[model samples]
Target: MDTCYLCGGLLELLGTLGRLAHYRCIDCGMEHSAGIDNDPTPTKERTDNDTDMENQGTSDSNHD
Candidate 1:
């Protein structure tokens, strides 16, 4: 999971703004944005299951 570089707090995604994805710190309320990674495979739309997996801190077993 992503964290706030400034305060080392947990970050909550604030959705995409323009071409950048935004995040906010839960403790400090700091806002930050970054570009999505340039993966060779194209990205797909996020789904509820995707969020559930992230919240559980588990990744697909298919990845090494």
Candidate 2:
């Protein structure tokens, strides 16, 4: 299962909205969304690199 970015907890799929897949952390209750193209499988393991890339993207978007 994919791990939560905030708390490293197991993430459960809440549902999908069009091409977006939504998840919620079981531990911290933090919500996350992934594009179906980016993540073909919701149960895929999340790596540290994935987290870093996501964080980088978020930071870059903040500059816009």
Question: Which candidate has the highest lDDT of all?
Answer: 2
> How far out, in Å, is residue 57 in model 2?
33
Write down the TM-score of every candidate. Answer: 0.52, 0.55
lDDT of each: 0.67, 0.74
For every model shown, the clashing-pair count is 0, 0
Q: What would the per-residue lDDT of candidate 2 be over residues 1-64, giving only the tens digit for each residue?
A: 7887666889888999898988888997777788876642334458899988887745434534
Tens digits of per-residue lDDT for model 1 on 1-64?
Answer: 5777777888787788577777777887777767776211112446899888888956466754
lDDT of 1: 0.67
Residue 12 of model 2 has an lDDT of 85
Indicate the worst ten consecutive residues by lDDT in candidate 1: 37-46
**Counting only residues 3 or more apart in sequence or on different chains, how many pairs clash (N, Cα, C under 3 Å) in candidate 2?**
0
